[model samples]
Structures are given as structure tokens and as C-alpha cells.
Target: MHDEGEPGDPDNKSVNSDPEVQQTLEVVFEEGDIRRRKSSLVPSTAPRPDHRRRKTQCFVHTLLEKHDGVASEDLNASYEGLAQERRVDKDPHSHAEQSQHSRLLTKKQISDMAFGIRELSKKLAQIKIMLHVRNIFILAKAHDETLIKHTRETTDWLLTKDESYRVYVEQTLEKNRLFDADGLLEKNPNYRGRLRFWTNELAAEKPQNFDIVLALGGDGTVLYASWLFQRIVPPVLAFSLGSLGFLTKFDYEQYPQTLSRAFTEGITVSLRLRFEATIMRSQDRENASRDLVEELIGEESEDHHTHRPDGTHNILNEVVVDRGPNPTMSSIELFGDDEHFTTVQADGVCISTPTGSTAYNLAAGGSLCHPDNPVILVTAICAHTLSFRPIILPDTIVLRAGVPYDARTSSWASFDGRERVELNPGDYVTISASRFPFPSVLPLDRKSKDWIDSISRTLHWNGRERQKSFKEWGS
Candidate 1:
């Protein structure tokens, strides 16, 4: 008759009420069963404190066992090795890290590390710069004993100074007594192996074989160097050793220093424009019909088919179309950008680049254009008409000069004062800015300053007596 909550009744008493009874129940239930029963009374999502405590104890026990016999020093070394391996995997090229511990590096050690990094950076820079110049082609004035002697001296100095550099001379020089085996050997015993001979054919075949062209003569020598390289021209360092040394600005005396700077520090270059002159024959017109069709259909015309020249020439100075050996004035029709521009009924016409404006263009009443100006100068060679004047056209224009099919006489064409070709009736010449420009190395001065000095010293431009000062005039 006792209630379930009553402590007096033995059968109705709680399991935890009597000590003997509880002990008997504990023995019967087991610890795991008691825990499960208690856990079932609470929410399943609640954290189990005993489980967390057991995990922590297991982790500590494993950690103690792992490091039970390891020394403190060995533990530090293990950590450092792991860090080093990570660094090596990150950047194989990088140097090892110097500071591993928390202690600050001494000032002297830090300075030494900085100096070592700077030295490494300098070595990398030098390695990058070393690949610039290895082969030098020397083009000196022909039939000049003084220049030849100077060339010998230069070759000797170059050979003695740098054993790595290879010198290339004109093949003709090999036959010359000046560059004979005895002469070369007298200068440098190893010249036979280091010095090489190159012909015009070889130069034409492999223009890129020469890294730099050293021209020792007047401006004409520089032009000859330009002529040798029809496609890509290397940097040309011209020494002033001839008459009218306009293009030859570098002093032969200072060549040692100049060349040294060019090799190491590098020299500034003035990329002068060149003209690709192609002579299109009248008979080729029929062959170009297919190219014309291709052009109409928005396809590029083949260069060899459309504007094939009898002999194409790359001119750095000018191209002249004139009455060669003909008494009558030549009749020439000019076209620009495929549009008819004018007809020249003069002795001849001169087409020159800005670099050549100082040459024939100046003599034909054309303006003195700066070499850097991107313009083509057209000047009449003794024009019959007084009103006809020189004209400057953009470099983008493609100039074509042709003899009319009904013309009286054939016209003559000369490229850079050479390679004279006859343009019969209906024949024409196409002139366009060449993709390959003439790279002329500047002297110690900048492009503008060098040009000014050349005109002042060489051409004696504006050399007339300076205007008297106002005070002098008054006196």
C-alpha cells in the first residue's frame, strides 16, 4: 500500500536509497549500462564530458611516448630541418635562409648578407649583358695605307684585349699584303685562328653573322656598310677617317674607350630609314594579272609576282631617275599610294630619305631634314620649270615613277649612286620605306647633338661670319 516515492517500503524504495541495495544494483547493472541509462535520460546532441577527457588523455599519452627519449637539441634540429625542406621545395634557385632562431642577427652579419646578395645580383646582370656582342665586322677604307695601318693596330688591340671576340674582315683583305699571314702573325700570333675573312657573298648570305659593323672611313664607308647589309643591319660604329666624314662621327683615337663602352654599357643608335627600290618591268604586268585578281578578292598579292624587280636595291641615301646619256629631258609619271600624283618633264627626279636630305637632296634645293624625321624628300634635278619645287611626302606612301608607254626616250635609274638601271618606255620603279632600317651607332653625344656637330664641323653649315653685334655696329 506504500507510494513509489516512500523510502520506508523496501520494494518501493529508489534504487539509490539504500547503500546495500544500491551496491547490489550497481553490481548487477554494470558501469556501462548505468552510463547508457543516464545518457538516454538527457538529449543525444549534448557533449559527453567523459569522452572528451578520455581523448585528451590518449593524445597526451601518445605525445609523451613519442618524445620520451629525444633530446631538446634534437627536437630543435628536427624543426629546423623541416623548415629547410619546405624552403628548398618552394624555390630551388633561392639560397638557404640564414636566420633560423629568434635571436637577431649582428649588424656585421646582416651587412655581409646584404653584400653577398648584391654581388649575386651583379653577376646575374653581367651574365645577361654578356650575350650582346661576340662577332665584330670591320669595314675600312680601301687603298688607304694610313687607315690600313690603323686597322691593323685596332685588330691587334682587340685581339690582345679580349680573347673571346672574333674579328671578321673583307675577304679581299686576306689577299692584301697588309693582312697577309706574316703581317697578321707579326701583330698577334693567334690572329690566324681568331681573325676571319668574309666575302660579299657570305655577308649577303648571312648578314646576321656579324653582331656589330666597325666602319673606318668617311660617310661613304658607312654607306658601303649599309649596302652590304640588304636585310637586317647590325649596329655600325663609324670612325671619322676620310673626306666628308659626316656619317663617321666617332674619333679613331678614342675608339678604344668608345668600343669598350659599346661592348659593356651599350651605345645609343639612330635608326635611319632606308628605301626598298624595285624596278617593275612592262612585261611583268601580264604576269601580275593573277596578283591583281587576288588583291581584288582581299587576298595579299605575292611580292615576287606583283612587284618583282629586275634587281632590287635597298638605298640608304637616295634613288635618282634621270636622262642618262639621253639628250632630251626624260618624261616620268609619278604615283603615290596607287594614285597618280604628277608628271616630271625634267632632266631627272631624286627621291631621298631624311638621312640623304643632306646629300643630293640639299644640292637640288630640298630642305635639310633631320635624320630622325619620317619623311621622303623629292627634289627635281635641274627642273626646266622654275615653279616646280621640292616636295616632302610621308614615309607611308609608296612612290612609283614610270616612263609612259608613249614616252620619247628611256629613263635611267640609279640607287644610292650605284646600280644604274635603264627604264625603257613603260618600265617603272617602286619606292617604299624598307622594314629594315640602317642602325648607326651614335658617338659619345646624343643623336641630336651628334647631327648638329657633324653639320657644323663637317659641312660647315651656317658658317658665314656671325652677324655683327649691335654695339659693334654702333662703334
Candidate 2:
């Protein structure tokens, strides 16, 4: 017989002839047949016998084998049960290659999503910066050739240096289409994309919405810009281009550097006080005449010169009530908060704010008060009475000035050296602090100088021979 053993050998022949060898062969053959039948009953995707054997040996199979006194039959039964349970607990088709591939794909997807989020964040940040810059309004002095030239040069410099600025000029000057004509912002080929023009009428029609008002002229130009915006005046950056640049001290040469600092580091601003003056006619003229009636009663007044003064005029400087074409001195009565203050017999009477104390008030022998002082000044212009002197009063009190129904002649009231109105007999003007104020921009170094430098440089405050040096006095 062809026994399943080493071929053509005496030992193999002997073993094949033995009964034990034949019995063992029959058992092995039967076990193999049973395994084949079980495998065929399972799905094609099921765990193979070799795989099941490896899994079973991993845990319980090896653990149980390590113990002594455990029967082979018990080990076999435990191996079969644990292997079947393990197969049912997991996916049959699951493999190390498929799991590794899935992990790699998940990682790549997460990386791409993170990259997209970072790019979106950068775009939003860029958009925010674009919306932060403010618009600029430019006001230049008119008629002066030197001032006009400097203003145009400054505008050109600003356009070249900062592309972000949205610049605007007055429409009246711009209408001429000539940069020199009233110093208007015209259709100059030199203008950049952001330049534009506005009209006072347009500004009045719709309140202008500008962040800063840049005045390229003298102190008067800055004051003019303040009057333009009756409701709200933007912070002013005034440059010195005219005589007596007391308020306008910034030099045009240092504008580029200084303006850059203002934009980047912010600027210092001083709040200046503004006052309102309203003129009115007395209700009972001839009957209410109490003092100085003889001169007014006999004079024949021209009908053309008489007009009712109703509206209030805002004054940054002083309001002057003077003898208008009258050969006689003005007899003006002053009242504080409706109380009898005094009577000023002078060429005129001037009511001024602390800011104006440096102007006409100074010329009239009034005290030079600091701009920060919250006070009003009353100075008489060439007073006829020796006792009449300039007086400083608290800004809290309302001031009233009038020609007593008995005044000798009429007086003229002018505000900021402009807008003259005739005051007839029994006429009174009421003056009070205004709610709106002017915010004037100051140099970054204003805190250290305290306006002393401006006074020294512009007005030459203490300019005089050094009191004839003591040593040279006798020589």
C-alpha cells in the first residue's frame, strides 16, 4: 500500500504496516474534511482558519496553555469558543492596510480645513484697516498771493504723501477753475483722485460731515472757518501764513512731519470759548428816557439808516459798539446779569472773550488773559472819564450794553471786525456764552511751552532794551 510516510524507506514501511499509523492517518483525514465543510458554510469574506488560529493564540489560547493540569480537550474547546466570539465581535474584512489608508485621508482633510480658516482670517483683518481712515476738509485764505501759493503747495504735498486722505475745498473758489482765483480747489491737473470741493450754500443746505478742518492761512482764516460751521466746528489745524499769526503758529515747512504725527499719534486740542451777541430796540423809547435824553430828543434821525436788529451774531473775538460817523463820544450803559454795572463814556465799548484779550482788547489797555481763562473782558475805547477802566468779569454772568433811551447819538455794533449794524436810541445788545465752542488743534509740544513761545516768537512779548545793563548805566 502507498502509505502517507517517507517514501521507499524501511522505517516508513514498518510504520505503515503498524495499526497505530493507519489509525492516525484516518483521524487526520477526517478532521481535514470537517474543516473544509465548515469553511464552505461561512461567507467568502469570513476570517480564514489560519487567521482564526493566529487570533486565538494571541490571548486565551496562550494563557490557558501556560497553566499546568489543563487537558488538551479543554484547551481545544476554549480555543474554538474564543476564536468564534472574536470573529463575531469585529468586522471580518477589516485589515491593517485599509485602516492605515483611512487615517491618512482624515489627516489630510483636517490640514486643508485649518489652512482655509487661516486665509479667511487674514482677509477680514485687511478689510477692517481699509475702513478706519477719516476725511479731511481744507480751508485756505483768499486774495493773498503768498497765502494762496503756500496753501496750494501744502495741498500738493499732502496728496503726494498720503493717498488715504479725502480732501475738500470751498466751492466758491473752485468755481473759477483757477487755483489762484480766491484760492479755490479747481480742476487742476495736479490734483489727485481724492480731491473735491464744497460750497457754503451746500454746507448750509446739508450739514458737512468732515473729521478735521485744515486752515492754511492766518488766524483770521481759521476764525472764518469757525463761522462757516455754525452748528459744529471740527478740530482745526491752523498754519501761519498771515501777519500776527498768534493763533496760527504752525509752520508750513514742518507740516509733513507734524501732520504725520497728528494722524498716527493723535493731536493736542484746546477748546476755545465762543459768545453770542443780540441787539434789540427798547419797547418804550421817549417815555423811558431817564438819562442823556436832551441830545437824542432834538436830533433828526434818517429813516433809511433805521432797521430792526433781530438775529444773534456769534463772536470769537470781541463785539465793538462804537461812535459810527458821530462826532461825539458814545454814551454806553453796561449791565451784568440785569444789574446796573456801569456807564462807559468813551469812543467805544468792547466786550471780548479770553481768546480776544490778545486782539483789540490788548490795544485798548485791557488785561492779557490766558486763553484757558473762563472770563469776559470789558474795555472802554479811549474813555472820556478817568475812573472808567477795563474790567474782567466771570463768564457765567450775562452782559447787556445799550444807549440809554437818552443817549446823545447812535452807535455802531460790529462783530469780529465785520457785520456792522446801527444801534438807534433805546437800543440794547445782550451777550452770553455760547453752547458751541471752537476746538483748536495744538502742537504736540504745547504742554511744555504753555503759549509762551508763541508770544515770544510772534508778538515779541518782552522785546526791549535789557533795562540798560546796570554796569553800562553809569558808563
Candidate 3:
């Protein structure tokens, strides 16, 4: 036995040789797997400080309307110029007032700003990746074929150079599976092989199996992607690749490296609150049982009944009851959980969540909200009443809004731009918050703060230019 034990291979690198200290290293670079195909990026606008600017100007205008454009413009320009000088000027003590102004940011505000800045940087990285994802998703349908062609060329280059991508696919889909797992892919390379995350295959396929979805698009893509996953939602990593991205956070260059760390070091996951919606119609009393069942459960189909049911829905944006193409107003009733708060005779009405504040809500003159808040914004599109104004509601109340059909008026109701219903006079529609919140992954650790900060930088919210350009110095 002693003779048979020829010396154990001392040169072996296997973990079994030395259990106390194990080492891991890559053998083959499997980064070549992601094949190249064109993808599409949904259109997105960058965050703007228009709202903040408008508000500030409104404040300025309210206080000094006579000065109008000139005063506000010159004052803002002066602030920007001074702020820039403070930043680049070598001597910190050169301007005592400037130093004091910098100090006025306060410890808490500074801490908050720092946190926001860091988060925004990370988000910018994610946005780049998200844009790539969008290019992959939307390349097929882009209006500009040249842009599509350009993406295809770029993707091919990245596929060859992006080693981390190959690692992602390889590590995610392990080869040499000795054991069997049910309902999993049969080690197929098509699913596991070189998947170029673009075209129809990516648009339809990876969604089923990807570990984390990195949105390389913008806010529109994020919204679209989140809406697709009705159940069993996965985490998303987004990088903005567009000119301006509210949802896209990561930078494009960070892809190869950041994704490397994400795989080797995992990524931070966030839970975004999503709201589900139910649609009900007026004049359908007989199907009330089914309709009511769906109402409580947020089901999709219309509940058919003998009586005309009202049109209402638990919507992500808002339940819109409007008079389409007509110069007439829509007499709509707004019902709270306990009782009807009031009625508004207007062109249309919008009910939205805090998450949707940046969306259609903002367009209708509603306030932007921090993503975490649970509040509803009720705005009148064009109200006939002089006193008609937008109202804020507690998120808890289920808001019922619809034109009274039996009132002998023609009105329409829409949910998230789809599923339209017409309310006959005297009939009514109902709306409320669905039980489910759209759960989206922010990708970065500081998604909310970063989102807010992006609003500042991209929109220049309350903006005094952080710095002065060389051209400005000549001015």
C-alpha cells in the first residue's frame, strides 16, 4: 500500500488538493456567445427642469411680472456666471461671500447631494446598458433604418470586444450538466449559446430566462418592459443610451466592466411599486357579478351583463374620461372610497399615481413626485368651470370617475391609452387603484435620489450652471 501511494501530485491546482484555500480562474473566455442582431430603442426625452423653471419663473413672474423675460433671464445668467467662477477660481478665499454661499448647502444637504450624485452616476451607467437593451429591442421597428444599420455595426464590434458578455452567457448557462432539472433549457446554446441580445429572438426569448434584465433604453422602454411582465417579474438593470434618459442610469462605457462586476459580484435589486387596474362599464347590471368579480380582482375582459354598466378601470396612469374631438365638456363625477367628493365639468380628467407623475401627469400641469410617495394626482384637462383645479388624493381611496351615461351625453373612457369605452347619458364609469404595483428594478443602489438628481442636471432644475464654458468666459 505504501508503495502504491506514489507521491500525491503536488503540482495539482484542484480544490480537493488543498481544501482550506481554494482558487478559481477562467479557463476559456466564453464571451463570444452573444450574436449580433439589430435592436430598437423607444423614443425618450431627457429630464428637463422646465417644470422647476416654470415654477421659479412663475414665482418670479408673480412677484415681478412687469420685468417678464429680461429680469429672470439676466438674474439666472448672473447666478450661473458667479457659480462658475466660484468653482474654477483657484483661491477658495478669493470671494468670502462665494465661500459662504457654498457653505450654506448645509451638512445634511451636502450629504444628500453627495448621495444623489453617486446614485446618479451609477444610474447613468445603467442607462447606457438600458439603451443598448432598447437598441436590441427596437432595432427592428426603428423609423430610421440608417440608425438601425449603425447599431448592427456597433453591436458586432461590441460582441467581439465584450468579454464580460460572453462570460455572462456562459456562467448563466452552465455547460456539462450532469444532473437534470425540470422545465429548464436542455443546455441548448440557442438559449445558452451566442445570443446577440437583439431582434425578435431577444425581444421575445431572453425575457423568459434571463437572470437580470438590463434595460439599455430609456423611460419609455422601462415602462413598456415593466408592463409586459404581469407576473413573475425579474429584476432589470438599465443603462441610458439616449440623449436624455430619466430611467436609463448606467453609462455605455461601463457595460463591459460594470456587467462584469454585476455577474461576479451580483447587482443591487430594487422593488418598484406598481399599480394594477380594472375596467368596468356602465349599463351592465346583469353581468355585475362577473364584472364586480373582475373589478375586485383586476381582470382583463369586459363583464357582459343585461344592464349597461359604467366604464372605469384600475389604471397605471389615470382613468381618462374625455369628450373626443368635440367642443363639448365631459360632465364627470369623482367618487372617493366613502363618498363622492365633487364633480367636474371639463374636457377630460386624469387620475395618476406618484410613479406616473413624470409621465402624462406632468404634461397636464401636475407636480413631479419622488418615486416613493403614494399619492394620486387628479387634473382637469380643460375644465369649463372657473374654479376647476387639480386635486391631490390619498393613495388609499379608490377614485371613481366617469361621465354619467344616462345623463344623455356622449363621453369616452380610456385606460393606459387602450381599452376605450363610451358612456351613454345617465350611465357612469368607475376607477380605482388596483392592488398590484408595477415592480421594477432600479438596477443601481440609489435609483430614487439619482433620478431626482438627473432631473436637476438634465433639466437644470433650479439650475445655475455648475460651471462656465470657455465660450462663456469670452462673453
Per-model TM against the reference: 0.67, 0.63, 0.52
- Residue 71's lDDT within candidate 1 is 60
lDDT of each: 0.67, 0.61, 0.46
State the weakest 10-residue window (summed lDDT) of model 1: 21-30
Which ranges in model 2 have alpha carbons more than 4 Å from their true place?
1-133, 175-193, 204-208, 283-309, 465-475
RMSD of each: 34.0, 40.1, 22.5
lDDT of 3 at 460: 70
Task: Point out the worst 10-residue segment of candidate 3 by lDDT.
Answer: 1-10
Number of the top TM-score candidate = 1
- Residues 1-475, candidate 3: write the lDDT tens digits: 0011111212311121223323232222223333445455433674655543243545546655555466544445464344333221112124433432222232233234334423433333343222111112222113334434433333444345443232122121122132111112243323233333333334333343333555545565566555544433344556666666765667756666765565454444343434444333444344324332223213321222322322223344555678876667777766654345676787888777666676667777777776556566888877777777777875544455645533336777766666777765534444433322333444445643776777786767786657865755553
Clash number for candidate 1:
0
lDDT of 2 by residue, 1-475 (tens): 0122212223211122223223111101122212345646867697766633343546656665443686555345454344322211111134423521111112223223224323332232222111122456778865666665665666666666666565666655554434553332354444545676777864444333565678987878877876776545666788777787878858877888877776665555566677767676544434443442222222322121222336566678889999989999998977764256877888999999888888899999998887777778999999998888789987655676778766789998988888899987767676766544566777755533656777788779989877664655664
TM-score of 2: 0.63
